[model samples]
Target: MVNITKDTEKEELIAQFWPQISRAAAGYENRPALSDELAQEMALSVWRSLEGFNDQCSLSTYIYRVIHNTAIDHIRRHSKISEDELDEAMLCESPTPEKNTLQAQRQKQLIVAVNQLPLSLRQVMLLKLEDLNNIEMSEVLGISEANVGVRLHRAKEQLSKLLAGMN
Candidate 1:
């Protein structure tokens, strides 16, 4: 009975947050294989961290914090994910026996452009994409709401320039 209760709690935890965690990892790494690895790592971390979770923040915000921190750690260990690498990642996903869909191509371009951004800008964009409000993003990134707004604005400008150049 004790084991069953613990297992059910862990399952609930994983089910509740896995999509957000996976999406964040995908945006952060921009590489399917790496993102998959990161998502698994994040899930494990969440399971471990749940043992001592406090109610200081909403669970969603806390999960975002963990995902963001994991992303930073991944970036530190393997700094500078390059444009060529992004291109290669895209190429690897190209359709076989069928032409590439326009939507897929645009998504690939957007991902590449995003990956080219500086860390601050990238972090802002990623959090914003996840539909997090500025306040929640501030909590995740440990910055002021004003600063998040500034970074997000700058990141949008840079992304426009990058996409324009790419196209």
Candidate 2:
């Protein structure tokens, strides 16, 4: 556990990393607003775990991994989806918007489809969308750069299929 003694260095570290933590958390916005609460919890966990960090990865990468694991943990804890709930959720269709709506329905559908991707693929895609190169994504995801490329390819394929099916 990281001892947060009343030290300026510890305070500075926390301040520097908070935005990365929040950006990592933003990946979960498609889930319930509970994700924000979970993000806060994860940030606290990262702070507590900081002393043990050995600088194996960049600070940003480490924080992102922490946030990702925290979100997965939260989902596991709260996701008690029964068969009926799954069926109902699967049956729920995107709502049609009027012609004058600010955003196109297709765009909304695409967003929903992206949100439905499995966590690993979704995380990769989100990081890619944020313009991180494969090396950076590899660090953030604790995978090889080649694996990052493969996953991004598969994620794009899956998203394409999902969007096609939505139409």
**Each candidate: what lDDT?**
0.82, 0.70
lDDT by residue (1-167, candidate 1, tens digit) is 12222767877978888888887787778778888998888888777766555777777787788878888888888756676887787778748533366776677677778878898999999888889999999998999999999999999999999999988
Which residue pairs in model 2 clash with each other? Answer: none
Which residue segments of model 1 deviate by more than 4 Å?
A: 1-5, 94-99
lDDT of 2: 0.70
Error of 1 at 142 (Å): 1.0
Q: Which ranges in model 2 have alpha carbons more than 4 Å from their true place?
A: 1-20, 80-110, 164-167
Report how far off residue 80 is in candidate 1 (Å).
2.4
lDDT of 2 at 18: 73
Tell how far residue 148 is off in model 2, in angstroms: 1.3
Among these predictions, the greatest lDDT belongs to 1
Cα lDDT for residue 154, candidate 2: 90
Error of 2 at 153 (Å): 0.4
